[model samples]
Target chain A: MDIIAQLFAGLSLGSVLLLAALGLSLTFGQMGVINMAHGEFMMAGAYTAFVVQGVVGDAGVSLLLALPLGFVVGGLLGLLLEATLIHRMYRRPLDTLLVTWGVALVLQQVARDVFGAPNVDVRAPAWLSGAVEIGGLALPRTRLFILALAAVCVVALALALRATPLGRRIRAVVQNRDLAEASGISSRATDRVTFFIGSGLAGIAGVALTLLGSIGPTLGTNYIVDAFLVVVAGGIGQIKGTVIAATALGLMQAFLEYSTTASVAKVLVFVAIVAFLQLRPQGLVSVRTRSLA
Target chain B: MRPRSTSRHGVTRLATASLAALGVVALSACGARVDSGSAAPTTAESCVDTSGDTVKIGFLNSLSGTMAISEQTVHDSLQLAAEEINADGGVLGKQLDVVSEDGQSEPTVFAEKAGKLITSDCVAAVFGGWTSASRKAMLPVFESQDSLLFYPVQYEGLESSPNIFYTGATTNQQIVPALDYLAEQGVTSLFLVGSDYVFPRTANKIINAYAQAHGIEIVGEEYAPLGHTDFSTIVNKVRSADADAVFNTLNGDSNVAFFKEYNNAGLSADEMPVVSVSIAEEEVGGIGVKNIEGQLTAWNYYQTVDSPENDAFVEAFKAAYGQDRPTSDPMEAAYTSLHLWAAMVEKAGSFAVDDVVAAADGVTYDAPEGHVVVNGENHHIAKTSLVGEIGADGLIHTVWSSEQPIEPDPYLEGYDWAEGLS
Candidate 1:
């Protein structure tokens, strides 16, 4: 029963990680930009939610209003970054890495300056405040909500890519930018929309994060590395692979932590990830693209 | 030949880069001081500018990083104390000049800034250090420089330094008394949960020994790294352990997540109460009263402590900061430390470190918490222990207290069980 509970806890944690990494997968796998400032976009979304909460004055309504508000705010900012900075470095992966890192630092400082250093309390709505308990198993409603949100996000993203016209354009550009450009698909426009949606997903992840813990300037930073790990380990451009990897890592961490110290568990996870990467360099679900060749 | 020569230069550059990186890694591993290039000391005699009509003292707090939220409040209280002192004709007819420096919430940074304050700034005394690590880092610097440090935070007892005066409650004054209260309440088994740090580690060690001596069963022990929020694994462990009570030493933002999880786990105060040493009124607001309304916290002072002195102090603090600003034990201790230092200086009729140290014994102040007296032996002050319940108003109200100030016992020599442990 304890094992089941612990695994359930891990699944919930992984769900949040998946939500956050969905954006990274889209940007890094599809857009071919490192986007080190991905975490900062998440921070921006969390702060937007905080701002909306202040305006609404009621927790439930504010949170409801914040989801879409956060998406738009995060998406528009990502588009702006794509135009001004990221677009120039699409061909230069290393330069994009450095520039995005710089952007992340700048955004972190801006958050600190605006919000102050203290962790802000974003009160969970009354309806989502408690937990649902069975005979021997208990699960927080917030965690369940986040898990559901993650599933919805992943399924919706998969559908958008497989079914929608915008998804087709993004897939075309991602597969062969030169060919997509020649076909009058407007690769730049696709990039903007893709980047916007990617960042918007990160924004929603940030909102889910606030439900679990206190929000701070570096709230997203704590999960950024893990999200990167999920994207990398899941294989580039593979949403299904990312989900599997996130769940596996989360469960591994929780179970490992049951026996060992947290720091040791983290080190073990990193070691395992490194070992796995050595075995499968192209990741779990490698896509054969011209870029890979 | 030109290509070979360029390759050789590249090899040399790579070697140099690797060597520099190795040196940095090695130095950081051993916690060795890297010389931070700052201004050279330009003074022949202590470098203190006592010739001016102002006496300069340093206010060192973590103005940035993880600790900034907590330390900023301490900074504000320290500022308030300084202002109040300066208003009261400024510590021996000279206005107080404060030299503020940010610790950046790092121990090395604390050590570096302490050195800077002592050598370059040449402040007579430096006040501020919330964590044990920060205090430990600054200890050697103060000792080597023959300076004074006024640390104003309740900490794990087992240390006493002549250079530092601890104005806050020691473990004996807070932790042991809380344990005593728990034992009196007939708690047989205790589950210890804490942030992995010096304070919690040491506090748990003492708790372990105390429990052993008192014939109590230890059900479980767990720790999470500082700033870690996911408490599900640990909370699951706590739930399964089924202990009579939990002694939580988790600090900072971690408490918010822990309480939320604990509440979600349906663990009420009546079933398995948590006696926290870290969470206070300031933190209750952040953690939410709904999550931890019935929870117990042990501290020397609370915003709801009733007294004329406390009323005045609270009002003055609220007037300076804001009405909503909750005054916790650490903030009150910081405010009291400045006045205590001033009183010591006045008693000695000098601002010199040795003089102040010599005159610090038996110095009493009608502090906001209550009447506090500085212990000459340990350099720690006497404090009353108050166990408070987290009220709906997000304030901690005292439900239990010692009724009198407990004498400072940095090295728990009074207890036989705490002999080898300390």
Candidate 2:
């Protein structure tokens, strides 16, 4: 029963990690640019949820209105960043890295000034505020709700990335942007849409995190490192690899915590991931470039 | 490379290293010349001098994290106390000069700041620590450097470092009294819940032992992660357990979640009461008055503590911050800690860490909490415990009192069942 309970906890936490890293995996791999401010983008989404909740006191009303709001805010922030800064450094990845790092610091400071340093509570809706007990096993209903949300997101994202016209275009861009552009794909518009979608996905992650814990400026930073680990461990650019790595890391964390302190458990996760990365520098899975080697 | 340029780089390296050494020598030398009470030679000495015109102290707190809202009050109160002392012609004719540092709310950062306070800044004593982890991290640095630290937040006891003084109540003085009050009210069974960390785990260990020794039975013990906000499952477990009371040790936003869920589950204070040690005036307001009102909280001081010293403290704090700003237990302890350090320095007659430590055991200060005396053997102090019910005005009304202060016992030595536990 405890192991089963632990698995649920693992799944719940894994979903949050997947949500957090989904945008980073896309932005880093497809665009060939590292978004160091990705976590801060998530922070913006959490704050947006906070403000929306404030205006609408009813939990149901707030959540009902927040999903699209989070996507728009996150997507707009991404668009603004790409237009004003990211586009200039697209060819110079290191310059983009430094610029994004600076942008991250600015966003953090802005959040500190606006929200203050205290952790702000965002209440869960009335409908989701209970737990189920079955044969001596206790489970938070909220965790199950998060799992459902994560599944829906993953499916919708997968279908959008695989089955739709834009999905094929994104895949074409991912495989060979020059070839796709030569074939009339309009790679510039594709870049804009991809960056927007990537950022909006991260914003959705932030909203999920706000539900699990209090909203704070550093909330994104906390998950960002772990998300990078997930992306790196799962093999960058592979969504299937991300799912595998996130679930594995989550299970490892749950097991480590049962035997030691939470801090020690986190340290173990980092160490284990580092060891895994050392063995598989290309990651758990990798894409094939058509060089005959 | 030319030999001349190599020699010049080498000379630059040598000169810079020597200057750093000289800087250290100068700092250690000033330890002998501090301007407070006179008790040491004016030349090179092992101790800091407090006999100068202005005694130097340090205020260390996290100014920028999850702990800032809570720790900032302690910082403000420490300054307030220093100002009040300087106004009264300083301690033993030395006005106070305070050095400040931000701990950044990390354990490693606490150690670095503590080292800087002792070795670089040369403060006579420093005060402030909210989490047990930060205090533990700083303990070795203080001991190795032979500097003094006055930790103001209540913590798990089982500790007695010669160079540090804990002005806040230990489990014996605070948690024990809270349990006793609930037991007196005929709480036949209780549930224990807190954030998953060292302090709460140690606290629950002590609580379980006390419950077994007494007639009370523990229904369940639950813990959430530090920033955890979900409590639906835990709340359901508590409701199913049907304990007469819940002893909550959840810190930060977890409290807000637990309280809201408790209310949502149709649990009220009257049917099965909630007793908390961490939620004070500052936090009660933050957790929302509606969720926490009617619940009981335990602490030594409220903004409503009665006495001339408390009146002065309240008025002066309001004057410093504003009338609407409230005072809580930990901040009062922090203010008292600085004054107590000053009193000990005056008694020892020097800021040399060991000299002041020798005089720390039984030093007394007429503080905001009313005459808390330091126990030199242990680093804790004697403090009265107050059990208060939260009112709509956002202040805790003292409903039960200890009558006299409880002596500091971090290890729970008095209780037979707590044997070998510390």
Candidate 3:
């Protein structure tokens, strides 16, 4: 029962990672742009939820409203970033990296100025406050809700990326941008939509994140490195690879942390990842094309 | 994708190399200065300026980073104290001039700033250190410079420095009294949860000794990195252990996550209560009152303490800051520290370090926490220990308190079991 509970805890954390990594994977897979400001976008979403919650005194209803509100806010901001900054730095990945880091720092300062340095409590609704005890296992309602939310998001993203015409356009652009443009797919529109969706997903992840911990200006910073690790370790763009990698890493961290200290667990996780990378330099999954050979 | 990453990796390597080179250069520059500076003779006469009508004191705290949230409050209270002193009559009939510096929540930064405060700023004394790590970092600087530091935060015992005055409660005053409270409540088994740091580790050591002597079983002990948010696994361990209570030494944002997870695990203060040493009235609101409404905390003072001194202090604080801002233990301690310094300086009739240290003995103040007397031997002030229960209004109310101000025992010489634990 204890093992089961620990596993559940791991999975619940994994679900949040997966939610965060999905957006990162999509953007990096398609645009090849390292959005270092991804976590700030998540912070934006969390703050949006905070603002919404404040405006509407009811916690449950406010969270429901904050989801879509966060998406719009995060998505619009991403669109603005793609147009004003990321678009010009497409050919220079290294430059984009530096610029986005600057952007993240600026956004963090802006958050600190607006919300103050202290962590703010975003209360889970009364209905989601307690655990559901099943025999010897106690499953927390908040974790269950986040798990369900992540599952829905993954399914929706997978289906949309695989089945829809928009997905086809995004996939075509990823394969060959000029060719897709020649075929009247308009790679620019695809890039805009993809960036928007990716950032919006990060925002939604932020909303779920508030249920797990206190919200602060650096809230996104805490998870940004781990999210990047998930994306990088999962073969950059593969959804299936990201899911497996996140769950495995999360469970390993949870178990290691239980046995030892948090810092030791983190160090071990990084060492394991490095070792795993040595074995599989191309990550767990990668797309192969004739040009690569 | 493979070709792109190889080039990107090369760029990253180049950037990292240059950054490392810059860091090495900067480090050597500081090292060279330190070597020359330490070789010189040091004296308090050349350190501070006393000819002027204004006496300067430094206030060093982390104004940014993870510790900013808590340290900022301490900084504000220190400023308030300085302002109050200046308004009436400053220390030694000189206007209080505060030289503030940000510690940046790093031990190295604390040490560096402390040195700068004593040598460059030439302040008579420095106040404000929230964490044990920062206090430890500043210890050597203060000692070597023949300067004084008034640290206002509860810390692990087994430490005493002639250069530093601890206005906050030590382990024997706060942690041991907390254990006594739990024992009196008939708690036979306890779990330990804390942030992975010096204070928590040391406090737990003292707790282990106390438990062994008092016939209480320590079922489990766990530690998370500072600023760690995940508490699911630890919470699971707490539930499975079925201890009568949990002694939480977790600090900062970790408490928010821990309490949230504790509540979500269907645990409450009524069953398996968590008596925390870190969480105070300021943190209760941040962690959410609903999440930790009935939780217990061990401290030397609370905003809701019903004393005329406390009432006046709280009112003055709210009037200065705002009505909603809560006065906490550290803030109260910081306020007391300023007055304590003033009283000592007046008694000594000088701002010299030796004079101040000499007159520190028996210097008492009617502080917000009640009367606190300076222990000349250890340089810690005697404070009344209070065990508070967090109420729904996001405030902590005293459920129990020490009959009198607990004497300062920084080395824990009073307890036989704590002899080697330090």
Better of 2 and 3 by DockQ: 3
- Two-way lDDT contest, 1 vs 3, winner: 3
The true-versus-predicted C-alpha distance at residue A28 of model 3, in Å, is 2.6
lDDT (tens digit, per residue) of candidate 1 on A138-229: 88788888899999999999999999999999888777667777899887788889999999988888877778776777777677777878
Candidate 1 wrongly placed segments (more than 4 Å): A291-293, B1-45
* The best candidate in terms of lDDT: 3
lDDT order, best first, reads: 3, 1, 2
Provide the overall lDDT of each model, using Cα atoms, as 2-decimal numbers. 0.83, 0.77, 0.84
Cα lDDT tens digits for candidate 3, B1-422: 32144332343233333334544743452332223236323643436998999988999999986688899999999999999899998887899999999988776788888888888889999998887777877887788788999999988878899999999999889999999899999999999999887788888888898999999999999988777878898899899999999999997788888999999989999998999988887777768888999899999999988889888888888999899899999999998998999999999999999999999999999998889999999999998999999988888989999979999998888888777875
Superposed Cα deviation of residue B354, candidate 2 (Å):
7.0
Clashing pairs in 3: none
Writing each residue's lDDT as its tens digit, candidate 2 over B1-422 gives 10012121232233233333544743352232222212212332334455568767778899865577789989999999899889888877888898999987766677778777766777778887778878877877776666788999888889999878998889998899999998899888999989877888999999999899888999988777666544545665677788999999988777876786576556788898899989888877556566678999988888898999999899999999989788999999999988898888789886677788888878988887777888878878999999999998879999999978889888889889889788
Q: Candidate 2 lDDT, tens digit per residue, A1-293?
A: 65676676577668777888788777764565568788898888888888899999887788767777887888899999998998777665556767987898889889888987655657678676645666765566566676787777778878998999998898887666666778998877888898998899888877766666556676666666667677777776678888888888877776666555455676688688767756776678776654221
lDDT computed for candidate 3:
0.84
Scoring each candidate complex against the real one, what DockQ results?
Answer: 0.29, 0.17, 0.48
Shift of residue A40 alpha carbon in model 3, Å: 1.4
Residues B1-422 of candidate 1 have per-residue lDDT tens digits of 10112221232233233333544753463354534333233222466777889989999999986788889999999999999999989988899999999998787888899998988999989999988878888887787777899999999878889999998889999999999999999999999999876788899999999999998889998888766767878888899899999999998778888988887777888899999998877777667678888889999999899999989888999998888788989999999999999999999999888899999999999998898999988999999899988888889889899999999888999889998985
Q: Which ten residues in a row have the lowest lDDT in candidate 1 chain A?
A: A284-293
